[model samples]
Target: MALKKLDKDTIIAMVLVSPSILAVLIFVYGFIAWSVRVSLSNWIGLLPDYEFIGLGNYLGLLKDPRFHIDVRNTLVFTILFVGGCLFLGVGLAILLDQGLRGESFFRSLFLFPMAISFIVTGVVWRWLMNPAMGSRMSGLNLLFDSLGLDFLVNKWHTTPNWGIAAIAIPAIWQMSGYTMALYLGGLRAIPESLREAARVDGASEIYIYRRIVLPLLWPVTLSAMIILGHISLKVFDLIIAVAGKQVALDVPSVYMWTTTFDGQFYGRGASIGILLLLSVAVLVIPYLYQTLREESTT
Candidate 1:
C-alpha cells in the first residue's frame, strides 16, 4: 500500500510538470539543435539545404575583415560598458547607503532607466549623441555649445575607431542603475556592526570599504559582470536604434542580423548565432558551476 501511494504521488508530480518539460524540450532545446544543424549546413536560400559543410562557415568568419571589426567593437563596447556601470553603480550605491534624505525617491529615479526598453533608450540617445557640427549641431553638442564649451562638442558616434566606445555611453546609462541595485543590495546585506567595529579599531571608512566591504561584494560583482557581459555580447536592438548598421560600430549581433536576414546567408547567420551562444555559455557556465559548488558545500 505504501509503495503504491509513493508511485501515485510521483506520477502526479510528473504529470503536473510534464507540460513545462515538454515545452522546453520542443521550443528551447529543439530550436537550439535545429540551429546547430543549420549552422553546419550549406543552406543559403529560400529552400533548406542540410548539406553538412562542417566548420567551413566558422573558418570563413575567422578570415572575414568585417567580423574582425565586429570583434574589436564588441571588445571596446564591453570593456567600457561593464567598467562604467561597475564604477558608477558602486559610487551611487555607496552614496545611497549613507541614509540620505529622499533615499527612496532617488533609488527609484536611478532604477527608472532600467524599466525603459533598450530600444527606447537607444532612440532617445541617438538624438542626444548626434554628431553634426556648426549650424547642424544639436542634442549634446548644442548643450555643450550653449555652455560655451565648444571644445567639448564633437562628432560622438561617428568619431572613427572609437565610435564603438561612444555606444557604451548609452549602454552604461541604461544598465548602471541595475548594477547599482545589485551593489546596494549587497551593501545592505552587510552588518552595521562590522563597520562600527572597524571604526572603533581606528580604521577610516575608506579602509573598511577597501578591506572588508569590497571583499564581501566580490560575489555581487561577479554576478553583475556575468550578466552585463552576456548582455554586451548579445547587444542588437540598442546598437540598431542608435547607430544603424555602420560597420565601425557593428557587433556580432548586428552582423548576424544582416548576414542571416538581410543577405540571406542562413549558414553564416546560424554560425554567428552559435558563436554568440558559446560566448554567453563561456561566461554563464563557470558562474553556474561555482554557484552549484557553493550550494553543495553549504
Candidate 2:
C-alpha cells in the first residue's frame, strides 16, 4: 500500500514538472541539435539547406585572419579580466574581513557596481576611456590633465593592437565585487579557532593567511576562475556597448553576431556559436564533476 502511494506521488510530481521538462528539451537541446545540423550545411542565405559539409565551417574559421584576431583578443581580454578580478576581489575581501567600522556600508559600496548592468558599465567606461584630446578630453583624460599627470592621458580602447585589453577594465570593475563576495564567504567559513590556534603557535597574520587561509580558499578561487573565465569567453554586449564592432577588438561572440546577422553566413555563425558553447563547457564541466564528486564523498 505504501509503495502504491509513493508511486502515485511520484507520478503527480512528474506531471507537475512535465511542462518545464518538455520546454527545456524542445527549446534548449532541440535548438542545439538543429544548430549543429545547420552548422554542418552550406546554408548561407535566408533558407534551410541541410546539406552536410562536415567540418568545413570550422576549418574556414581556422584559416580566417579575422577569426585569428578574435582568438588573440579573447585570450588577452580573458587573462587581464580574470586576473584583475581575482586580485582585486581577494584584496577587498581581505580588507573587509578585518572587521572595519561600517563594514556593511563598505561591502554594499564595493558590490554596487555588480548590481549595475554591464551595458551601462561599458557605456560609462567608453566615455571615460575616450581617446579624444585637448578640449575633447572630458573623462579620465581631463582628470589626468587637471592633476598634471598628462603622461597618463593616452588612447585607451582606441589604441591599436592592444585596444582589446583596455576593455577588460570595465569587465573587471563590474565583476570583481562578485568575486569579492565569493572570497568573503570562503574567508568567513574558515573558523576563527584556526587563526587563534595559529596565533598561539607564534604565527604572524600573513603567515596564517599564507599557510591556512589561502590553502582552504582554493575551492573558492577555482569557482571564481571558472565563472570569470566563462563570462570572458562569451562577452558580447559589453564590448558592443563600449567599442562597437571594430575588428581589432573582435572576440568570437561579436564575430559570430556579424557573421550570422549582418553577413548572413548561417553555417559559419552556427560554427562560431558551437565553439563558444564548447569553450564554456570546457570550463564548467570539470567544475561540475568535481563538485558532484565532493558531494557524493561527503
Candidate 3:
C-alpha cells in the first residue's frame, strides 16, 4: 500500500511536468538538432535543399574574408563592451553603495537606460554618435565643436578599422546599470560587521576594497562576465539599429542574418548559428556546472 502511494505521487508529478518536458524536447532541442543537420547540408536558397555536404558550409565560412571581418569585429566589440561595462558597473555600484543622499534616485536614474530596449538605445546613440564632419556635423560632434574641443571630434561608428569598438559604447551604456545592480547586490550581501572589523584593524577603505571586498566579488565578476560575454556574442538588433549592416561593424549575428536571410544561404546561416551556440555554451556550461555544484554542496 505504501509503495503504491509513492508510485502514484511519482506518476502524478511526471504527468504535471510531461507537457513542459515534451515542449522543450520538441521546440528547443528539436530545433537545435534540425539546425545542426541543416548546417551540414547544401540548403541554399529559399527552398530547402538537404543534400549532405558534410562540413562544406563550415569550411567555406573559415575561408570567407567577410566572416573573418565578422570574427575580428566580434572580438573587438566583446572586449570593449565587456570591459567597459565591468569598469563602469563596478564604479557606479561602489558609488551607490556609499549610502549617499538621494541614492535611490540616482540608482533609478542609472538603471533607467537598462529598462529601454537595446534597439531603442541604438537608435538614440546613432544620432548621438553621428560620423559626419564640418557643416554636416551634428549630435555629439556638434556638442564637441561648441565646447571648443575640435580635437575630440572624429567619425564615431564610421571610424576605419575600429568602427565595431564604437558600437560597444552604446551597448556598455545600456547594460552597465544592470551590471551595477548585480554588483550592488553582491556588495550589500557582505556583512557590515566584517567592514567594521577591517576598520578596527586599521585597514584603509581602499585597502579593504582592494583585498577583502574585491576578492569576495570574484563570483559576481565571473557571473557578470559570462552574462555580458553571451550578450556581446549574440548582439544583432543593437548593431543593426546603430550602424546598419556595414561590414566594418559586422559581427557573427549580423553576418548570419544577412547570409541566411538576405543571401538565402541557409546552410551557412545555420553553421553560423551553430558556431554562436557553441560559443555561448562554452561560457555558460561551466558557470552552470559550478553553480549547480555549489548549490548541491550547500
Q: Rate the local accuracy (lDDT) of all candidates.
A: 0.93, 0.93, 0.93
- Clash list (residue pairs), candidate 3: none
Question: Model 3 compared with the native: what TM-score?
Answer: 0.96
lDDT per residue (tens digit) for residues 1-298 in model 2: 9999999999999999999999999998999998988889888888878899999999999999999999999999999999999999999999999998998898888899988888899899999998899778888999999999999988988998999988999999899989999999999999999999999999999999999999999989999999999999999989999999999999999999999999989999999999999999899999999999999999
lDDT of 1 by residue, 1-298 (tens): 9999999999999999999999999898899899999999988987889999999999999999999999999999999999999999999999999899999899998889898998999999999999998889899999999999999897888998998888899999999999999999999999999999999999998999999999999989999999999999998999999989898888999999999888889999999999999999999999999999999999
TM-score of 1: 0.96
TM-score of each: 0.96, 0.96, 0.96
**Regions of model 2 farther than 4 Å from truth:** 1-4
Per-prediction backbone clash count? 0, 0, 0
